[model samples]
Target chain A: MSQAPSDIDDLIDLMARLPGLGPRSARRAVLRLIQKRGKLMQPLAQAMQGVADTARECLQCGNIGSDDLCKICASEKRANGEICVVEDVADLWAMERAGVFGGRYHVLGGTLSALDAIGPEDLRIPALVRRVTEEGINEVILALNATVDGQTTAHYIADELAERCAVTSLAQGVPIGGELDYLDDGTITAALKARKGF
Target chain B: MSQAPSDIDDLIDLMARLPGLGPRSARRAVLRLIQKRGKLMQPLAQAMQGVADTARECLQCGNIGSDDLCKICASEKRANGEICVVEDVADLWAMERAGVFGGRYHVLGGTLSALDAIGPEDLRIPALVRRVTEEGINEVILALNATVDGQTTAHYIADELAERCAVTSLAQGVPIGGELDYLDDGTITAALKARKGF
Candidate 1:
């Protein structure tokens, strides 16, 4: 049967493929956009187009920015000789939002996977190794996830940079807002094992 | 603090205002888009722009379309002396997806809300009445929502068009795939009240 004239329906289909939006949610969003076309939808469309046209991956790091080199990589004051290597740009943005880490970041794009045939060459591991020596980094913090692939990638990076610089990792423990009762078995064990002075 | 380089952060903020997305989800979605610029992001941006530029509400009915008259409104085959009334374009799209109603639709944009200062003039109720006589509509089916405001709007329309045409509404019963055990009290009562012969 014929439907909402291809263009609108196509937009709905694409919106449904977004991270948190399902078919029902996407339809509602599209309708909302249509209703507020001048105020919301048009501006959203323009912003997306602007971002799509300008956004690019940093040559030095994998962080997304409007230029060839991201702001973190371009800034001279941020060269604090500490590099936080992350698995995704989302993690880098998360780190930036926390406002704790003062040094620069190196995004690996994704972790190495045997099932997916993604190796060190597939990720930014080689670029990271080169950056360690070129930038005179003192410490390389592996801010990867706790997943099997994430750990494997972290370990691989640590091994690769064993001779060049001191390698470190994020402290494995209960999250800041986590309760011991709700904490997973592994996290509880790690938090207890790594307990510090009161 | 200068968070996320302005442009990216702005996009995230705008995306956060969408129907089903929050700030965190919008951030994740933006990162996802930035990561896959070529495959997903660019296409989505283009689609949004396309729909934004083309989509307009049908002047007669409130249905969204690229032109003044929507396909359903323009089509002669769908002029089956019936006009289905809905609260939003999303509801219209949902009805289209179901492919059950073989007639045109009238989108009221929103239900009557006294608290919000919404009234008959605020909705498409007057336009619906005009269509009943102009289009020789034998039936005006009220496919409004099940909410109080929706029901209030339905009853108001039914009262307005009592002499003009047959005012009908969607049957309230247990949905096709719905289980009685999981049904809410109101739905159960409605289903029992509207029970038909076996």
Candidate 2:
């Protein structure tokens, strides 16, 4: 009936909250870290600590970075009058990995959702709008997901920006309901290359 | 022709090194973090930082813990004169989730591997032997993987402890070349229940 120590229990609880990891997996992960303290666990812990101390949200692009502005937003060369608008940072990273999108990005954080009560305002839609006007962007690429919410958000953004800038989307290579995280770099690049008007 | 900034590249390089994550996946994951900085990415970064600061290896059993000794190793109730040995923490967690074993665990870190230049010393074999004699252990259960190296390591441990204590192994329910992490709780429990002399 006695409970595990508070710290261990806390760790397990927190780990359980991570995606694809349950309480059991968390326990195992914790145990493994303890066992390989010198080689794996300690280094992992140190990395976590360093990141914790320095990691922050990039003020301009919402990317997780160690500085106020993310590497992408701070780069002058990336300000090529084109902005890749994505539903999530993962999508933006996917574009970057393709190494073809010679522009910056706008991370919307999430898609519009009626079920989740998410709306355009709930996402960074307003910020995205502001960026298009302030940054003198000519093209705003909609790289949102193909999900209902994703499309809804994309349509909303496109509608809001229709009068101001050229709007396009990644080609139909991403499978329906597929997350950007699941796509290969090649597929993302191909999709981006074949983008069509929204 | 320009490369990604050094810090971003460094992050990608480190992420690519994670198991099951290649350069592509790492880049995608990092990008995801950037986009969802406020919700998913920022929280993840904070969680990683917290774990980094607090996570440490259990000196006694090689489990990850917030302190020097892991929760299992520190608990007096877990000291039941029986130590279940596993190749990885994932396996140890599988056993715990099965809720079959009442004893504590000894994480071997990994199995002996001539190809990887790994040896008994590289694993926790020496610590395990020390635990057997020092802790007055009665039984040592080998719950390693079904790989050749896992079986070889089990045999080595059995030979070392033949005269000292009861040595047993997980039963045949574990599929050939199966990893304990992939096994369901029921199967693991069944395997544990049907365990026989090594």
Best by TM-score: 1
Assess the local accuracy of residue B57 in candidate 1 as a C-alpha lDDT between 0 and 100. Answer: 88
- List of clashing residue pairs for candidate 1: none
Evaluate every candidate with DockQ and list the scores.
0.64, 0.16
**What TM-score against the true fold does each predicted structure earn?**
0.95, 0.63
User: How would you encode candidate 2's per-residue C-alpha lDDT over B1-198 as one tens digit per residue?
Assistant: 113445556655654554445676656655544444466544544454456567666799976667898889988999999999998766765677678888889988889999999999999899999999999999999998877899999999999999999999977678889999999887798789888899
Q: Model 2: what is its DockQ?
A: 0.16
Q: Number of the top candidate by lDDT?
A: 1
Stretches off by above 4 angstroms in model 2 are A1-9, A23-32, A35-80, A134-137, A173-198, B1-198
Docking class of 2: incorrect
Tens digit per residue, CA lDDT, model 2, A152-171: 88888889999999999977
Best by DockQ: 1
Candidate 1 is graded, for docking, as medium
Lowest-sum lDDT 10-residue window in model 1 chain B = B1-10
